[model samples]
Target: MNIHKFFANDEIATRPLHHVMRAGIFLSLIIIIFISMSGRPLAQTIEYDLKSVSVLKINLPVSQAVTIVLSDAVSKIVAANAEIADAQPITDKSIYLVGRSFGTTTVNLYSESGAPVGLLAVEVGVNSADISRSIRAALPRSDVKVNTVNGRVQLSGSVNDAYSMEKVLEIVAQYGSPSIVNVITLKGGQ
Candidate 1:
């Protein structure tokens, strides 16, 4: 029997394959268009609320660097004052901020899509290493521990007498007043 004659006798077998092929092509083209459109920008400009800008306060030690992990991928970072601090992108979602001087500056992070992420209020100050050494040398008989937290010098431990405590406070004040939290206790007092 002839193939065409045999197929023509069966309505199911004679169904046009071109119709199925065309339907498949149409479906594939629709999927491709949807995917391409999803990636394209809907508008030319992205608006941001300037009045509701978020601010992050960060304290870093002079000559030291700290890493800040962001909620979104960062494309660029700009420092308000380069002389006070330097910000460099380590990855798409993090940045390394280095303190250059004893001052405060702002760092603005930009998203990969060119939108402002937020502002970082970075304060650069002296580390506690030098201050700790000086305090230890001045009060060799007393036990004193010095640390820095949130741009403040924290002094904790014990002193021999009130004079020693006052001396420690005085030395810390020389560096920066109102930036010292003295938790030092007298030997005989609570």
Candidate 2:
């Protein structure tokens, strides 16, 4: 092996290959730790589906409609639960998701050839502002906060105890089919 190639200078070349490998590995570990502690997201959100990402996420409030323009010509659309949300085609490539009630459901779209095109996760919720206002009043003592982020209830912050947490969740459940992005932290038992 040409050991000189691995070293930048004659002095570094004096180190054995195993020692050099260990140093390189240790440096990599430090770099990784630094990056993770930097408070920036090292990786970006995965573009789940380039074809479906643009149009398939439906975050409609109750008594509202959201128009989705699909890249493919939609021949047929089926909703898993029509009572919660329904789809009406606006065009061959577009549709309106009518929020029928409070809940979460999925709608499958098909192309003209009857091949499945995309699956849309439909969430029908009460207005976020209204839900937030009611939640604050209902739970006056806790530090938890629930927000409808990307059509799902991202429940964060901390509660006094597990019972308080459950009560917060129960209150929030009435608003919609909450996804509950679990991120509660502090909990001291009495």
Candidate 3:
């Protein structure tokens, strides 16, 4: 019962202390090795073609039903097209629905000059949540950005010109809720 007796007995305790210290060191080394191995990066190439992208969202609400339907429809359409190889799920619930099914189909729509030529938006009605989710999902590879402020979804990004801006607007218009007040596009200032 005496705590001091264990440490005071040199012959009985010295060997155990040594063993415990060794085990502690061994465990520490194993942990270090495991962490280092997991942290090491695999050989990979970072894409230099990436452009700056941003998205601004307005304080709005989107319905879930519309988002689900739109994503499903778009995914099917893009899948049947030969030009679109695949669609990846995006962060935006609305767009993510399509992206999840279609697999990055938007990237395929870019023109040779790095301009967006076409957009596929759902004509169906959705709520604010679905719309916001879909837009957020789709913004990762997008050079511009999407965001919401004071019940409005704001689009800010670089495009070829006014026509391209219109095209972008048309694409997003499909997934909007019935009560969506506006679609605002801020030109990349040419």
lDDT per model vs. reference: 0.75, 0.71, 0.38
Name the top lDDT candidate: 1
Local accuracy of candidate 3 as per-residue lDDT tens digits, 1-190: 2222245445545345566678789999999999999986542212112133221111113321112212112222233332322223332222322212211122222333555433433221233355445544544333345544432455565554566555556556775422333444444554
Better of 1 and 3 by lDDT: 1
Q: After superposition, how far is residue 167 of candidate 3 from its true place, in Å?
A: 1.2
TM-score versus the correct structure, for each prediction: 0.47, 0.49, 0.24
For model 2, which pairs clash? none
Model 1: per-residue Cα lDDT at residue 81 = 94
Error of 2 at 103 (Å): 2.6
Quality of model 2 by C-alpha lDDT: 0.71
Sorted by lDDT, highest first, which candidate order results? 1, 2, 3
lDDT of 2 at 126: 59
Off by over 4 Å in 3: 1-61, 64-142, 177-190
lDDT of 1 by residue, 13-49 (tens): 6335666568789999999999999997532222223
The candidate 2 region of ten consecutive residues with least summed lDDT is: 41-50
What tens digits encode model 2's per-residue C-alpha lDDT throughout 35-143? 8889875322212242736345656777777677666677898999999899888787777778888678999888778887788887777566665676678667667
Looking at model 3, residue 54 earns an lDDT score of 21
